[model samples]
Target: METKTKKTLLPVQGKILWDVIILSILSVLCFLLPFAHYTYHRVQWTVSGLQFITGTSVQDGEVVIASQWLLIAFIAAAVLSIVFALVFPKIKKIRLAGFLIILGGILELLFSVLFTMQVQYIMADARNAGTSYAAWLLALIAVITIARGFHILYKNKVLSPLDFMIMPGCIYFLINNYFPLVGIFIAFKRVDYSVGIMNSEWVGFSNFTYLFSSSDAWVMTRNTILYNVAFIILGNLLGIIVGIFLSEVFSKKLQKLYQTTILLPQLISIIIVAYIVFAFLSNEAGLINKGILGEGNEINFYNTKIYWPFILTFVNLWKGLGYNSIIYLSAIVSIDKSLYEAAYVDGANRWQQITRITVPLLKPSIITLVTMSIGRIFYSDFGLFYQVPMDSGALYSVTQTIDTYVYRSLLQLNNIAMASAASAYQSVVGFVVVLVANGIVRKIDNENAMF
Candidate 1:
């Protein structure tokens, strides 16, 4: 017989020292590497009416300016935090280090912004100068180091083996989700590529105008919110119903068959699903038109917008119900069977048992799922709105949503600033809505609410 050993949690050795070493290396690199380039140029232009035509000009060699020293201050702060972490084992001292790291990160940001402004004012052509990749790496490293200090301060000791297991995922989230948040600045910038992202003039909410100023804004916003609300309500309702029904069936063979059949649709790609929909809905050479409805009174499903609301709702349910139901099914399966047995002994019928026992038990899972869904209410699946309709102009009024609108506008205008602004707006609004929903849930039923 093979024996299985239990794993134990232990603090990682030299974890703090490793972090300090990495921080020290990056800090030194900040001073040694070229922070940003300073370009000098002479411009000669010929006037034609109010327009000026540029002529060829020689570029002066790039200069490494003195502003790089600002990073030295940041490096000093990081080193101080690391030293404190090593020398002082007290909680207050470690916390002080965390505060210092945060202050250093903030100062770094202000310094970089001030440097960009100085570059813009000094030489007109110098505005085109770009910061080196090293500078960006330094900023990212500073933030990570700050976060590390805080984590250490929280635990007041080395991280355990269990913490190490989750470290990779935490780092990935920081890089993929949190780091890209720096690009939110693009939403406020005019974004002249000739002048780099940092050097671009701040337009202050001008990019947001593109989204709300259009005549179709109201229609798109309304459709997006309404469809999401319907999806949340209907999806949860049907999922719960099917899950409960499945749990009631005692046969193993029939239950597996039903589960597999329902889940198969979720595994299929949306593009393939669109083609299947096209086969049934297409006016010309369609299964419905030629085979079922026959020749005379064929419906053009693609062109007509009225039928789409129903079609889309049905399609969403068909594709999503299987996956959504699995959550409720798992919860239901874990419920104590003794409760149902006791209810039966009390002469409770199936409907009464479900109402009194099953529904009440499922409350926590339902509230959690709904709260998460609310966070993404402003977002829509792009392929559903764009590809499923076959890009029909007539159907756009009903099918158009925030995701599709941003995609189309991105292609048409090729303005990244506008797209960034739209995305930032969606994220902010969704965050606020989720917070409000969670707050209401907490007040109504504190035990079932998600914190």
Candidate 2:
């Protein structure tokens, strides 16, 4: 049989009508469900739909999904659920059909269930007690009605409710995240607590001068930037190599074991990870001293500045490689096996298949990882440098990055100004690096540039 050509789905305005309806229902359900819904005698998932939506037991906060929550997740689910309903009817539970449709319907229902669960999770996010469900619902309804009113007045469907996705996201990002970025200039200000934020006098590069004036500035900054560069390079390379090797391995069980093993460090917490590292490197009680070498002498890891760069890079990779590999693995899996068959027909060996087919296809993911990484090169992993070293001054030469330096200062001086200034410095450096890197990527491969 000939290969099936795929058709791409395009977004349309009319597609969002279903979303409006579903969202309206979700909003109303959220508003009334808690009062109408019930829970088991003991707190459990068997609670009423409203309870599932409102249940509080800090997912991020004692936060009920809706109970004491005030129903923010309910409104969110209602709104987004409507959008999914309108645009992707094929995936909608009420509209599913066909032989594979049974599985598809189960998956869609699972998706919806999981999606609502996630809304509850985000509502409990460390961000707040929960967002205001009433305010959000009112805003959503107002926005939808206004859009429809505008559509009727213009007598042209120039857009639809789905338009809010891109528009609202852009606007909120600009207002909340990007707008605050302008404060980077404050890094150069002589910010005194008494002077207030904006009232603080502008020092015009004085803050930067003060930073550079420190003797440890160059060393710390250099170490931070260099370590990040090394992480971005080595982390992605190792991740891709491991991902590709796993993809090529014949035994599915072994591949899964390796994947899980590489991924474990990423899943574990940094604090726990520091303790784990200490178990091996501790001077007296460490495995290296007692178990491995059969010696009881302490290694005095605190003073070992020379070993830290390598140690930091290794830890960074160990923590990140599995997570990053998923991207490469996805790219590899997406490649048409026909390409591999063609390579094999040309007498290409397994090595040749990888070099010729796998690496080339994975370039997009690699570039993306590198570019995103370059954007954060000035920022160091706070956990790795600070907690891992136990904050020993002896290792400061290698471990004291801009982040840890700022933290150390924060603790010693209680100086928020300096901390903000250091953060601003990292942002400026990181932003400039991202812009330059994007420009270079654009020159080399226009499609890959983030812009």
Candidate 3:
């Protein structure tokens, strides 16, 4: 029976093997076709993928070097696919061949886009120049090859329909989230726009000096960590209180109304919040000045350093409370009601039932949120710190967290490397803080800790 099954599979495998081999060869041959066209000061130049990969010379003795690594990768993928098709010629090998084809196609597409962008950047003054027809044809061929590869894998049961369903989200994250992580290199490099990012000169830790060597370093660091500490403590405490209150409310309509009312501040734009704050605190026309304090007692709230810490803390909590409460409420809702019922039967008052049952059960949710918050302790709300303070130089001593400081530095110095370094530093510190916090939690309660 096994022999008969193998005999019957041979014809199907043979057909797929030929198809893979043919597509692989065609993808390689695409390199010989015209890849891009450029016109520099009335001179027309058309270069093939082979020429681009080898480096092409244009007007003014300028050499446009397309990334050779991409060419090498494409060739490698094509070679591996063809070898697999011819040598193994089994269902598993055929599926592997298909994956290789898809990979080669993606590489080819990236190469085409990057090559075109490089040429355009180099010859900025060039007119009537862009990717040639062959380039588009190469992309089209790549798409078809990728589709054929997926078809083979699916037909062979190597990939299920569920895999296809999740494929889009996987691709989205690969492109948007994971791919940009490569930009971390920008923190270490002296970026030159004339040459692309990969070709930039290395500066080591010099970019990092902007963050630590400055006089404001202590001020920003202190403000960032302290503000985050307050936010985590106050936000979680109030959120649990609000969540518990909402959970206990018997009227469904009243619960929803209160939920929406509390949630409205979270939905309001920070910019609008700033202006609303301005309306109350404005030195000249503010309601406090015009209505309560009268003209003679008018105070400059934006420039006053003392008022901002409380103002910012209040604003942050107001905006975050509803969202935070909703999260805790979900966990509260999921708790077994029988525990609370048993506590009440044992002569426990409402407050005792809450303390003994509700809050204890909420320990896991609180720990999870607190652990996550610790990871971002080195960061702050940019709009809340910057905009609410109205960019007051007087308030810098009180309000300059790491994020606002980075934004101000970028604006004043126009230094991309320095900005990247600041970001990288915050990320590293936050990551460490999270690990330490989680370790402490894990030591205390192994089950509640988030790994």
Candidate 4:
């Protein structure tokens, strides 16, 4: 006798079919519920169904009232979505359509809970006595439903394979990084903490009034631009020269030792090194005083703001040059030795070789480093400005950049929202600078332009 066989399905293969079946059941249960509902209240004239939908309190003898209209609306949306998805599962656009429906359901459920409490609080205000929120509840239902629809549309999307890999990262960024990014709006607002993040009324660019449409704007702007310009040009130049010289000067036996010596300061935190600098620069019992100069009363370096630009640049070079040089070292070492040997055989001097072979060969590394560094031009190292200065008021004039200004403001205001806004502003300005710099590079040398 022949027997008919039943096919077995795997987990994923069975899930869609099961979802469709469950959705059918849920849709039937949900669609049958009444759209309008009523509640009873106490501590006042006994209230019943106030309108098409009502909001009230059902406290003690007074029963709390809630319509759950938004909840019903979401359930209705979800039910309609299941039916729609059952009809069209393969269409790409339906993915977005279906997501919007689920989003609406979620938002409606959320706001329904929120508004329930709000309306109850307003009505139950013993201060209001017999005041009722019946009309307000009806209006809330309409507003919430519409808000849910807009929010749903905003939340919908189509995910691809790449998005699957990046979705978790994207979520992390949205919460940790992007949400803080919204603080840029504060830069344009006369922001205060009273109204909180969203409900604050707009101020029509009053906050930026401090930055643009002023004269001191040019001072800060010029200082930021020129300081970074000097650092990039001077930093890379010194780093490359040092890297090449060290690569040549050290014997193979001493190479690691010499590299480590150059790199040792870099391994230590900048804050720690700033203290070391303090020891050297201390006005009393300092090594520079007792050991070197032996001068009486010593120089109060902190009070002299005129000397800071040079001192800060020097410190930056000492701490950062080795690391930057190491990057150039990788490029230097990878250069073809045959070119150097041929030049040597042709009687090329070391200086000539550097001019012809080294500089030209290092162009790619130069452009890459310059491009990356340019992206940070509008920003400054926080530790250098804050810790190195020991937060002295004396150095505030020359040392204050956009970052330091923000830090000082936050310290004074203790408002995290404004801090976030300042950070967002720095990022945007830095990004703009990089793009403009890249455009200039592309015009000058397309091959070396980043992107």
What C-alpha lDDT do the candidate models reach, one value each?
0.73, 0.65, 0.81, 0.63
* Residues forming the 10-long window of minimal summed lDDT in candidate 1: 46-55
Top lDDT: which candidate number?
Answer: 3
Badly placed stretches (over 4 Å) of model 2 are 1-176
Candidate 4 off by > 4 Å: 1-179, 212-219, 295-297, 415-424
Model 2, range 1-451, lDDT digits (tens) per residue? 1232112222322334443464356446544422221123443222233444545543323434322333444355455545554545454222221212222222333333433443444443343333334434444454453444344323334445675457678668756886566456566666666635555777787766777898767987898988988888888888888888778878889888888888888999999989998998887788887887676555666677777788778888889989988778878989999999988899999998998788888888889888998888898889999998888878888888999978876788776567767777777778899999999999999998889
Position 124, candidate 4: lDDT: 53
Backbone atom clashes (below 3 Å) for every candidate: 0, 19, 0, 6
Question: Could you estimate the TM-score for every candidate?
Answer: 0.75, 0.62, 0.84, 0.65
| Top TM-score model | 3
> Each candidate's root-mean-square deviation in Å?
9.2, 14.2, 3.8, 10.1
**Candidate 4 C-alpha lDDT tens digits along 1-451:** 1232112223322443344444435433432332222243433333423321344443333433343564455456556656654654443343354455445444434444443443344345343334234323433443443443444334344444565577579658756875545347665555555644444667655555545564535555566666677788888988998888876864876777777888887788878977988888777766776778777756788788887888778887887888888898889899998998999999999898888998899998999899999998987777877788777888777777777767766788675444555566678788898999899999999999997
Our model 3 lands, by Cα RMSD against the true structure, at: 3.8
In Å, residue 283's CA in model 3 sits off its true spot by 0.8
Give, for candidate 3, the lowest lDDT window spanning 10 residues.
58-67
Model 4 steric clash pairs: 42-62, 57-64, 58-62, 58-63, 58-64, 59-62
- Per-residue lDDT tens digits for candidate 3, residues 153-202, read 79879999999999999889978876667579899998886776778899
Which regions of candidate 1 fall more than 4 Å away from where they truly are?
1-26, 33-59, 63-89, 92-168
